[model samples]
Target chain A: MNVLRAIYNFIFELGDTALLFLKALYWSFRPPYRWRELFKQMEKFGVSSVSVVFITSLFTGMVLALETYTGLKKFNAESVIGSIVAVSMFRELGPVLTALVVTGRAGSAMAAELGTMRVTEQIDAMYTMAVDPIHYLVVPRLITGVTMLPVLTVISDLLGVIGGYFVSIVLLKINSHTYIRQMLNHTDLHDLYSGLVKAAVFGLLISLICCYKGLSTKGGAEGVGRSTTQAVVISSVVVLVADYFLTAFMF
Target chain B: MVEETVIQVINLYKSFGKQQVLKGVSFSVKKGELFYIIGKSGEGKSVLLKHIVGLITPDKGKVLIEGMDIHQATGVDALKLRRKIGMVFQYGALFDSMTVYENIAFPLREHFSLSEKEIAEIVKEKLALVELEGIERKMPSELSGGMRKRVALARALALNPGILLYDEPTTGLDPLLTEEIDNLIKDTRDKTGVTSVVVSHDIWSVIKFADRVAYLANGRIEFIGTPEEMLETDNQMLKRFICARLEDKLMTSLFNACRSRGSCTS
Candidate 1:
């Protein structure tokens, strides 16, 4: 019975989330466009997140290069370490790690802020004032998430490749010429495009889930805390799960 | 002249899971009347007010604002109807992200194409009406509880709404602040002639300003009448409710007097 109840709740909430997505789309295209709020959210989720995404992606690439060198040297494939790091960074680590970092940072903040507004009746106040909360609140964040994630992923991919180069030549004593030639010959622009596509999808999912958790929040401070935690947990898990399918289809 | 009803609830029934909050509750507010819904906390006074604004839909009835059923109103119709009603929440509910100036200007900006100068003029006028001028740049967090309520009132009045709903406007205020808010509500109604509905358990506020009072208990309105009529009622439940308040007030006054004399005892 408990398992059945859990499944039932899962399907119900999934349907609710889909409905919220449709409503967000519906409101987004209509005007009295909140350009100010959209720009504000873009700066928050995109610009403010640059430092963390940079650090995370750069270190991830360096670690990947180190591990790949140790493994490939046994098989005499050490010259291809640059290609491995580049492909991995562009196809998976860059987007996924960037998304995960952002989920923890901006996504949780979105949930907490919206959840606070919900508990304090600020959302209700907006609704009563003849402004649709979906338009005034959800749409701006949705646009920011969809647009900013891919931009962040591009930065992440670039820094990641640079980090891998530093690790390969400076640390692993690999030839710089061979590293660049092999990496360029092995990877294509398609790899970067697919990764950016994944980033955009991740952005949408994270913002939608966080915004939904927030707007549905009840019970005041405790409820806001719960929603923020759930937003991070659910969006982080969704990013990983979606990454698998995206990689399978793209590759 | 007979006052027309601006707000009405007919046979409203709402339940949350197993807890039935409103069971067939019904009432109407006449034009320009200062109506109060008085009940204990958690008795669904706020819930009933939310119905009027269409924030919470009823499981079984109709809430009509100016004869248009709010639940049935859709899209632009719903927005138009909502513009006619303004609600001041218990905690002020000012947008924490915006300053008092932006908060007051929000509704005007959304509904009209008024220029910055016009919006500023109206915002100042509303602030002055609430007796809170020249604090527009202050954030909601910067204001005291009473000041927050005043700013909320200023924002609610920005559009010159036809009907105003206040959910426990004086709930967390001190005695002097409570009187100030009550007076503000009274003054607002007198000046604007906007039909007002206030949901509160503050018996003193009800007595001080309510032109009519509805006592909500046991998921229904047990009494609906003037403050004088409510005080002189024979209904046992109402008498108990009023007597409990009177007794509490009496005890508070006695304790205060003792403390003032430095003869207070537990």
Candidate 2:
């Protein structure tokens, strides 16, 4: 019976998430559009997060270069270190890692904010005013999610490559010219595009899941806490799991 | 002038999990009437209020507001009907991100195409109506409990809705504030002539302001009459309910008769 209940709950959540996502997408172009809110969210989720994304991506790149250098050196292929780092960062690490960081920072904030509203009946306040919470609350965040994820992923990609260069040349003595040439030669526009595509997908999932958790919150203060934690954990797992499929589909 | 029934709820039933919150509950509110639904805590009064706003749908029966079935209405239709009503939640539920001014202006801005100047004028008027003036720039966090409730009332009135729902408006307020809020409820009803439905356990407020009171018990309105009529009733369930509130007032001259008997409403 518990197993049956679990499956039922999972299916219910899946349907709920899909419906919310679709409604958000539909309202994105609807009239009485909230340009102010969309821009506010974009700044919050994308621009304000640049520093954290930059730091996380940079370190991730450096660590990747360090780990792969020792393995590549066994085959006398240390020169290819830059190529490998750049490709990995662009195609997978950049978008996925940036999304993970954002899941902690901005995504958690979104869930907490909306969850607080849900628990406190602010969402119902909007409903009483004849305003659809989906159009008013979710649409702006959806726009922010879809638009900002790519922008943040781009920043992460550039910072990650730069960090790779620092480790490859300054730390590993791989030579700056060789590092630059190998990275540029091996990496293509497709790699960057695929990562950004992944970022956009990841962004939509994060925003929708967070909003779902926020809107569905029931138990008051404790419920808000539960929702915020669930949003971060679920979105992080989703990003990782989707990364595998997105990587395979893209390449 | 307040003769027509604006809302009619019939045989309403609702359940959550294994617990049934509302069972066969039924009532009606006339236009411009100050109606109170009083019961013990956890009697689903708030849930009943939500039914009128399309926030909750009963498993059986229907709520008709101006002849439109709220539960059966489509999304657009439901929104259209909901626009005619405003609900002031217990804790005020003011949008935390916006200032008091913006919170009041939120419904106005969403539903109306007024200029900022026009919106500000309306906000100022609502602030004045609630007797809360010149605190618009502050956030909801800055306001006291009474002040927050007033702001919420102001926000609810922003759209000039024809019906206002109050969910335990005086729940956490002190005696003075409770009197103040009760008077505000009366004043707003008198001033706007909007149909008012209040869900509360505050017996004093019900006795003071309600034109008609419905005492809900076991998910049904077991008694429906004027506050005076309710106080004079011989129903055991209601007497027991009123006995709790009549405890403090028993020493007073007005409640002396019920007190001498030692079994008011019981």
Candidate 3:
């Protein structure tokens, strides 16, 4: 019975969330559009999160190259470490890791801010003032997330490949020509495009989930905390789960 | 006595799960009247007041503002009607991120093409109207409770709304500040000719400012009359509440004088 109730609630909330997403998209192109808010959110989730994305991508690529060095060295195939790391970073890890980092940073902040506004009746005040809170608040963030995530993923891919090159040539004593030649030969534009497509979709999922949880928040300060934590957790999980299907579709 | 009805609720009902908040509550506020809906805490005074502004839809009933059904009205039409109503929340509900001036200017920027100079002028005038001169750059956290409420009042009035709804306007203020707010409420109506519906349980504010008072108790209006009629009513719940309020040491003398001045025989 409890499992059935949980499934029912999940299905119901999923439908509501999809409806909110449609409303956000419809309102974004209407008059009195919030371009300023959208740009502000883009700066928040894109530029402000650059440092964290750079660090996470750099470390993940470096580690992937180092881990592959051992097996590749035994087989005398260490020169291809650059290809392995670059392809992995560009095709999969870059978009997913950048999204997870942003889920923790910008997504949680969106949820907490909107949740606090919900608890304090600021959202209600917006409605009473002839403003649609979803249009004014949610749509800008949603557009920002969808557009900015791919940009962040591209940055992550570039920095990640550079990190892998450093690990392969500078640290592991591989020939720089071999490393660069292998990376350029094996990785294609299609790989980068696939990752960016996944990034855009992840951005939409995170923004919608966070804003939906936030707008649905009740109780009080405690509720805001719960919503924030849930936004991060739910967005991160959904992004990972969706990555598989996105990858399969790309193939 | 010859006023038109600005807000009307008929057989309004609302419930949260099994907890019924408002049960068949019916009331009407006259145009340009200073109306007070008083009840103990958690008895749906705010819920009923929210109905007037179309914030909370009832489970079953009609809330008509200017004879336009709020729940039944279409989206654009309902939003158009809601533009004429302004609300001051219990906690003021000012946008914490914005400065006082920007908070006052938010609705203007949202719905109008006014210049920054025009917005600044209107914000300054509203601040002056609320007796909160200067301090436009300060955040809501920096203001005292009374000052926040006053700022909120200024923000609500910034729209020049036709009807203003206040929820628990005096819940946390000291008596002197409460008196000031009560006076401001009356003075605002006098200055603006806006119909005001104040949800409060404050004895002093009701005694001093209410042109008509409705007593909500146990999900229904137990009594409704002028302030003097309230003082003379023998309804057990209202009389008990009055007696408890009269037990206050500072207010006892005040209530005694008020009783002698009115038709209280209790």
Candidate 4:
């Protein structure tokens, strides 16, 4: 009975969250839209997210290359290291991993910031001033996340391939030329497109969930912390789950 | 007595879960009236003010502003109605990210398609009204609490709203700042002729500024009269609350202790 109740609450919460997302989107284009606020949010969400995303991608690429090269070389299929790293990074790992990192770094922070604003009545102040909170806070985040995630994922993919190349040439002593050839042979436009699409979807999921949780936060400081935790956890779960379905469909 | 009614409330009922905060509450404010709703904390004064601005809907009854049912209005109409009503939150509720200038100019920029020159003029004028003209470039955190509240008042007055709602405007201030806020409220009322609804527990302010004072107790209006009438009231609850009597203090402390314990036990 407890489990059933939990499931029921989860479904109900999901429905409510979906409705909020639609409301936010509707308000995005309405009059009294704050363009300056939108630009400021983009700077916060997209520009500020770049460094963490870049550093994480670079390190993740290096680790994936090291692990995959070790496993592939055991079967004497060392030359296929490039294709292995590239396909894995672009088709599966890059979007999902970057999204998880962003959920931790950016999503939680966004939720906490907005939740504080909500508890402090700053959001209500915006409403009383004829400024829609949704347009002022959420829409720019949505736009920035949707646009920037794909670009970040592309960088991640490139870095991962480069990492694989370094391991193949310097560490594993495989011909760098052979590694590049194999990667080019197996990787295609479809792989890149699928990854970009997944990144966009993940971006939407992260921002919508974060903003929704933040805006809905009640109580006070404690509630803000809880919303931040919930935003990160929920966004990470959704990103991982969505990645599986997206990968299945793409393949 | 012949003054036009600017805000009318009929049988307002609001509840949170099983706890009713406002029970069949009703009142009306005449145009240009500085009406004060006074109560002990948790007596639903803030809740009533929120309904006036349509921030929270009453579970039952009606809130009418200028003859329009607020809850029934469409989005366009609701926004239009809201523009005529300005609210200053208890905490000042300044946008932390914006400077005082941007904070005061927010409504002007949102509501009007004015040039930068016109916006600057209006912002300066509102700032001058609140005696905050020079500190426009400073962030909210850079200002003192009293200054923040004054800046908030400037923001509320930017649109020349027909109605102004202040939620505990003089709370947590020294006597001097409190007096300044009272004077500012009077100045604003005189200059704009805005119908002002103030929710406060400040007895001194109520005595000084309220043209009509309403005492809230047990989620309902217990008394409504002029300040003189309120002072002469023989009601025990009104007397205890207004006088801040020792028994009233003890009761409130006991109530808070029970509420905190209830939360812990639950």
Winning model by lDDT: 1
Residue-wise C-alpha lDDT for candidate 2, range A89-121, written one tens digit per residue: 988888998899988999999999999999899
The digit string of per-residue lDDT tens for model 4 on A1-251 reads: 99999999899989988887898789767766566766786677666667877777777777777887778778988888788889988987888877887788788889998999999999998888766787778888887678777877887788777776776688778888888898899989888899999999999999989988999999999999999999999999999999889878777
Ten-residue region with minimum lDDT total, candidate 3 chain B:
B257-266
Ranking by lDDT: 1, 3, 2, 4
Per-residue alpha-carbon lDDT of model 2 for B1-266, expressed as tens digits?
Answer: 44899999999999999999898988899999999999999989999999988898789999999888987887678778998999999999999999999999998888778999999999999999999899989999988999999999999999888899999999988777888898899899999998999999987777677899999889889999987788777788888787675563562444545334422233
Regions of candidate 4 where Cα sits further than 4 Å from its true position: A1-5, A31-34, B246-266
Considering only N, C-alpha and C atoms within 3 Å, which residue pairs clash in candidate 3?
A: none
DockQ for each numbered candidate? 0.81, 0.87, 0.86, 0.61
lDDT of each: 0.92, 0.89, 0.89, 0.85
What would the TM-scores of all predictions be?
Answer: 0.95, 0.95, 0.96, 0.93
lDDT score, candidate 3, position A143: 88
Expressed as tens digits, the lDDT of each residue in B121-210 for candidate 4 is: 998999999888788899999999899999999999999999999999988988778878887897899888989999989776776667
Question: Candidate 2 chain B: worst 10 consecutive residues by lDDT?
Answer: B257-266
Worst 10 residues of 1 chain B by lDDT: B257-266
The DockQ score of candidate 2 comes to 0.87
Best DockQ goes to which candidate?
A: 2
The residue pairs in collision within model 2 are B239-B265, B239-B266
Off by over 4 Å in 1: B245-266
